[model samples]
Target chain A: MTTHPHMALVLSRICARFADEERHDLSVLRDVTFSVRTGSFVSIIGPSGAGKSTLMRVILGMMLPTSGEVVRNFSRPAMVFQNYALFPWLSALDNVAFGLRMSSVPKQERERVAREKLKEVGLLHLENHYPAQLSGGQRQRVGLARALAIQPDFLIMDEPFSNLDTITAEELKADLLKIWRAYGITILMVNHLIPDAIELSDQIILMGAHPGHVEKVVAIDLPRPRDTRGALFFQDVDALTEEIRKIS
Target chain B: MIRSVTHPQAGPWHRIHLMRHRRALILMTIVIGIAVLFGISGYFSGVAWPTLLEAVLRTTYRLALAYGIALVLGVTIALLVGWSPFIDFFFPFFDILQNIPSFALFPLFIYFFGFTDQMIILFATSSIVWPILFAVLTAIKGAHKDLNDAATIFGATGFRRVSFYLAPLALPAVLTGSIVGIAIGWEAIIGAEIIANIAGFGAFIKNVDISGIDASAVAGALAILVIVFVINRLVWAPLLLESSRRYAE
Candidate 1:
């Protein structure tokens, strides 16, 4: 049971297994346990075989866990993918409105909400453009807008800024922080950059490979508007990097 | 990268509509040019313009009916086979069925529909359907995993997935497949007409070309070539350009 008050999500002894070509079970995740605090930003950092992506899918109920339990306090959850998997045939506006469209919302209402989300992401002027017509960073913003269009209380993101250049990524990070604060939603993200997690997260969950499991959960108490160049920020980044190296 | 290339005045969607209008104008000019050329040829060669025009219309109508039937039937079957859990079982079986010599089925169709327009139409449909079916099947098989996941996440499950995701995904394939199918349909319809002694362009030509390869045959060939070129310019090419722009990733 979660002793922490206001827990948004909880995973108890979660494990995932896939059958190999030879009909043998290959364990991918084992005994993974974690709880995400309500309205908090939590980041998962780990090595290649750490099954971070699998865990996220399991949490989203896209993939079934072989064993263990998931308790989600929030009803509406949305994900921002690493690849910005917008439907190529749809314009940015239609892509943002896709969820409401699927649920049979009236066209006018869905478009109104989609436009609002796009405006929030600063992509309202480019909403009619197709995914191929948008740059990488713009596409990611469109993706963020799409996830937000559903008015989700729980936000799940998988390396959402990995494909971006430094300047674009930094700008997006600032927007994300502002949106997080305004929405007061809980966010669970999978990322590799140590300094990024330290800057944006309240707690970081570190996982290890070879039957992936949680190694440690480090709490970040850094002040808001983090100074990346400061000694304390570098100290946390160095400590996190060292911990991951040990697991690797 | 965040602010890359935003069109302040007009987006690509606007440009595409403009391009379509230009394509329509160009197609009209080509049609006029072909008509004038054919008129001069008819004036000199003592060609039976009325009879040839009737034959062309009859052949075109038959081919159009055949293509319509084939398109709907082909795409539906392709979706079923491609998305089925038994794709591995059905796909190879379908491949073997498509390999059967096309003309070999004419006798079977004739047995059912006889030496009439129905026989010719059915024969052409059989030939046209294979390319559309196989093309769509290949497209569905090779679609990206990420797109599939995205569609599911956004609630495109059950029959909704067919219309919202798979159909559009198979659109470019449908265009290419129809082009190939129409070419094969021409051969099938002509051959069936000639063998069955039915009244179409094929019969019209065979009646006039008794001495083999005369001015009538050349005029017939030229007319057919012009029709093919016009269809390519007005229909397939424009759609191809639009599909590439709309669906490219």
Candidate 2:
């Protein structure tokens, strides 16, 4: 019903339901409404059974909402998964070039572009390795590089750092911020990590379960390169933590 | 141009190539040496070397032709149905067809092609096609849903999906199915030849002198075994190794 300028995406009264055992309708998402501004970083954080992943699928157009409307002003969206979905049969370079290959780009051109992306991700040395041969951090980097190769207007991530070690996850988070700034791309991510959501997001959308719907949207007014150890950072984290606890 | 791929350090690719060539040469020498000994002895424990080799060549030709037909037919049918919406509906129908006795249908083949090589080859093809079809069909049906989603999201669609994603995904199954099909094909081809008295290794063995318990039959069996071993070593083993390494999830 309402609109905003430079809106990358606007979901209006979105609802999703699936058939459970006994063929009965089980609602997962209910009338979820939100708008993402272009080039802003947004995070959706919720507890278990809050339909976070289901909403992600709906947003990516991988699954249709049972009833609702999604208005998209941006095209060429890409997704990064928690499990890096690299093809086991392809080398890292080929994996990164997969989208270009599908677009019918010539082999030489795609490989050159893919190599540049790999170099950007600090993975030029491992371009010849298969996904199975790489460590988890390295594999996710390849996945990130693959998504980046398509020159997407928006990036969707579903718990991208949940599978890695603490150190690796932290490193990737900083790299992702740099990537986001450099590419000037919009990001929509879903996760249960409250502190992480506070640290990286321009806006954090909180959701409640039992037919998931938005609880609140909190805007981070802090300056760029937010200092997590500072007083204001922890205050925001504490307030968001309280909000999440109340809904969860 | 695409950059040439090479490991940072020196690899064993050259050494492995050299070893394979050496092994093949040694096996060839042994096979030829056996024929020479048979020729010089004027009559060895086996049949005359020339007749044995001739029969082998004939049978190999027939089997190769039959297998070629089976491969093309089986892969085509499986892929056509496997990726279709009607795959589940067609599966049971294919199952019933596969259960029919291949030998019982030989009279029908004989009627169509007479007692010629066509009849035997067709009969062999019938027996070989089942393993390949079922293997590929099951593989496509049982693949992880995520892989299909990934393929679609990355821009593989329509014919491109079939060619680039589905075909490569089903390759390991194809190799396994072909191996099984070849084994079945050999039995069908050899049996059909012996029964119909065709000009192949089977018939050659059937007509040889058996007063000394058939020297030529023993020789033909040994020769066939050697051929099967060499083919497996030179073709199937390497292919299998490569498939498992490259296609594994």
Candidate 3:
């Protein structure tokens, strides 16, 4: 029941459950409480079935929490889905412009802004390619561009890089960081990769499942442009990984 | 996996337009050419060309009317059946309804509508409606969950959701279903004409010299083939290709 002036989003004791097909009670999320700070990058990291995605759905208002409240002080929140979710029928440019169109932006302005966002995401040249024609990394870039084109107050990512290969994932992480820094937009992401959560986030909300709830909140106070190869960075990552493992 | 054959540097919209128009143009040309050939052969065949033409035209109009009714009603009914949980209980009834032979109802329909074009059109519609309805139902049932989520998240609701998301997603199924429906419609329309001894292609075929099947009857059959070819090319082929390019997985 507390609110901070600088808070972008606040989740107060949120709970979500759904009945199975056979009408069996199944609790997916329970008693989850957290706040995302303005312009901060936060990662919700946990093992699969830890309600990471369910928590996201609750925040996005895609699914109603069985109980509790989510308070948002921001406007125009957009999500980048795990599987890219780009319309297969639309080319990259049209896909990126989709949100703008939904918001009733004029066609000319929508395309211009979409192209600019595509450029920012390093996919301007591939804007004419359909999602089916793009590589995994390229498709994710389109997804990111689409989310950014809406000029959201905050961005939600559901395992944004989990679909890519190792090299592509790394490249995308750097690109995401660049975009986040440049835009200064608040980001709340769900990731199962412990190292990624440690590396990219300003704060990590570690979670545990079986009726999923928050386990611990760990702050990654590491300096920006973090050197992942450095021993201190590795030490921090290892510690965070161990903490997550112990909780899960 | 499903790249269009366009110039490497072509803009996406430009390519889309080009591909659409190009396929449409090709199909139109084929249809026109077939119609012209049929016209030339009919002129030389020395058959009662005027009566044959009248019957063909009559059958075309009737079939078109019946198909139109079926398309509108089929899509509407299919969407209604697929749309909500309340309607879901009626699906088992629909399952049984679709399996019932539409042709078997012709005699019963004659009793109701009494040997008129109304009966024939209704009979043809019965034959046409089921395939489209079933195809759309299957499409709705198998629609991608992610796409549904995306549409909901993007604020496509009510009519907007139906027009933009559900209709487009169900398009491939719609096209395939229409093809089947139209084919069945052609059969039903002709059979109705013959059985009812109505004024159409089936009547033309039935009344022809029965000694060994006259050249005029052969010409009539060829004309029907030409119509089918034209429809397949101009209507179904272009749609099928477009669906493969945009809608199909």
Which candidate ranks first by DockQ, i.e. highest? 1
- Give per-residue CA lDDT, model 1, range A6-64, as digits (tens): 88899999999998799998899999999999999999999899998889889878899
Which residue runs does candidate 1 get wrong by more than 4 Å? A1-5, A20-25, B1-46, B80-89
Instruction: Work out candidate 1's RMSD over C-alphas.
Output: 4.1
The better-scoring model by DockQ among 1 and 2 is 1
Q: What TM-score does chain B alone reach in each candidate, compared with the true chain B?
A: 0.83, 0.82, 0.80
In model 3, how well does chain A match by TM-score? 0.97
lDDT of 2 by residue, B1-249 (tens): 898687532346446755876797788788778866865876555457797898888888888898899888988888878767799999999999999988889889999999998888889999989998999898889876656666777887777877877787778888899899999888888888888888888788777743444667767877897888778888887897678667655
Arrange candidates, best lDDT first: 1, 2, 3
Each candidate's fnat: 0.62, 0.41, 0.31
lDDT of 3 by residue, B5-107 (tens): 9764355654676687678668767866775786687643667889999999899999999999999998888776667644567767888988888878888
The list of candidate 2 runs beyond 4 A from truth reads A1-5, A20-26, A47-49, A207-216, A238-248, B1-46, B204-214
Q: DockQ of candidate 1? A: 0.62
- Among incorrect, acceptable, medium and high, the docking class of model 3 is acceptable
Tell me how much of the true interface, by contacts, candidate 2 captures: 0.41
Each model's backbone clash number = 0, 0, 0
Q: Score each candidate by Cα lDDT.
A: 0.88, 0.85, 0.83
